[model samples]
Target: MPSVTVRNVPDEVHRAIRVRAAQHGRSIEAEMREILESAVKPQGRVKLGSLLAEVGRKAKLTDEELGTFESVRDKTPARAASFE
Candidate 1:
């Protein structure tokens, strides 16, 4: 197995990890492993169009309102770019 050595961790941070490990009934090494795994996990992006469609389906937006939202979204990039 490959080994890693993490250096210069603050004393308070180490103490907090020890407390959290005991709270979860896990060894500090096991707790650190789990934390690292979760912290480094990749996340997926949700498409705005798909998300809006889902919300519209659930909450019932009119065609005019949906069109207005798309129009506003389209112009937002241009408006944002003007500031830059």
Candidate 2:
């Protein structure tokens, strides 16, 4: 898993987060993660996969047609780009 380090937080802000974390019965780190997650990907967001599936449903694509797409698609591993 990846990790993040937030530097130079104001004392009052840190204290507020600590209080909020305590109120929610979560560690400060866990509370911060939840805060960051909600800030970026909120509950009302429309994700791409859901949108595409909706489009497919409206288009009335059959399972056999979708299976043909899978059979014809590329399965190669991508190569890293060289900056040289």
Candidate 3:
């Protein structure tokens, strides 16, 4: 097993960690290990598109409400630029 050293932890934070360790019936080192493990575990990305699709299905969204960005595009005429 690999060992890690954390330096200059605040007294208040250390006290809180100790209190939490006691509550969980674990040594401070064990509690810290658990916390470190949980913190480093791989987390999945929030899929906004899938989430929106589910939400839209639940909400019974209309075709118009499921809008595209074309309507919001810049409608101004394009100008020709000259470089001499």
Candidate 4:
């Protein structure tokens, strides 16, 4: 086992951690560990080119249609990207 010390934590942040620990029925240390784990994890990225290629192959989109579809898709607002 290794010991670690975190210094100069703000009072409000410490108070929030204490509140979250109490809400979750965990010690502050355990709550902090869980928060750190989620914060530091690596996440996946979507490759739009690869995805479009796969969709084209399956759907047999003509070059003109594919271009049109891509143009339309490009104009759409992007939603949040998540990896879970």
Candidate 5:
């Protein structure tokens, strides 16, 4: 099995990870391995935020242009409810 070394972890973060490992009955190394594995695994759905970002970048959609569309949407008044 390949091994990984994470450096410069903050004291607070290390303490938090240790606490979480204890909560889950895992060693720090096992918790870290679980965390790493979870990160790289497929999430089983589209990530909308990142997909929208990529789309906007590829289509060159500017913030101002998107904002203009939001501001200029049709504001049709609602019709009164009719009872049969």
Candidate 6:
């Protein structure tokens, strides 16, 4: 895991973060991590599954048509190629 060092944060900001952490019942470090994660990766971000489902709807693909992929899927493991 990687670590980050934030230097020279204003005293007021630090105090506010401490108070927020206490309110949320989380350690200051854990609260900071949650804040950073949400800042970069918010709840409103488009997700892969939602995007694929939207594409399927636009394409008018039926559930039965999608289910056919499972029946026709090849589950065999591929063999390593030999160089002779």
Tens digits of lDDT, candidate 4, 1-84:
466789999999999999999999999999999898788865565577778778897998888977877676655666778998
Candidate 2, 1-84: lDDT as tens digits:
689999999999999999999999999999999999988877888965568667877889998966676677667866779999
Better of 1 and 2 by TM-score: 2
Say which prediction, candidate 1 or candidate 6, comes out ahead on TM-score: 6
List clashing residue pairs in candidate 4: none
- Per-model RMSD to reference: 11.2, 5.2, 14.9, 12.9, 16.2, 8.5
Report the lDDT tens digits of candidate 1 across residue range 1-84: 567779999999999999999999999998899889888866675777879878986888888877787777753442334654
Per-candidate TM-scores read 0.48, 0.55, 0.49, 0.48, 0.50, 0.59
Q: Candidate 4, 27: how far from true, in Å?
A: 0.2
Count of residue pairs whose backbone atoms collide, per candidate: 0, 0, 0, 0, 0, 0
Q: Which of candidates 3 and 6 reaches a greater TM-score?
A: 6
List the candidates ranked by TM-score, beginning with the highest.
6, 2, 5, 3, 1, 4
lDDT winner, 2 or 4? 2
Residue 78 lDDT (model 1): 29
Which pairs of residues have clashing backbones in candidate 3? none
Model 3 lDDT at residue 62: 74
Per-residue lDDT tens digits for candidate 6, residues 1-84, read 689999999999999999999999999999999899988887788966578668877989989976775477677866779999
The lDDT values for all models are 0.83, 0.86, 0.82, 0.85, 0.83, 0.86
Give the poorly placed runs of model 2, Cα more than 4 Å off.
47-84
- Give the number of the best model, judged by lDDT: 2
The alpha-carbon lDDT assigned to residue 40 of candidate 2 equals 80
Which regions of candidate 1 deviate over 4 angstroms? 43-84
Candidate 5 lDDT by residue in tens digits, 1-84:
567788999999999999999999999999998988899878886765567667767989999966675576566865779998
Please give the lDDT score at residue 54 for candidate 3: 76
Record all residue pairs in model 2 with backbone atoms less than 3 Å apart, i.e. clashing: none
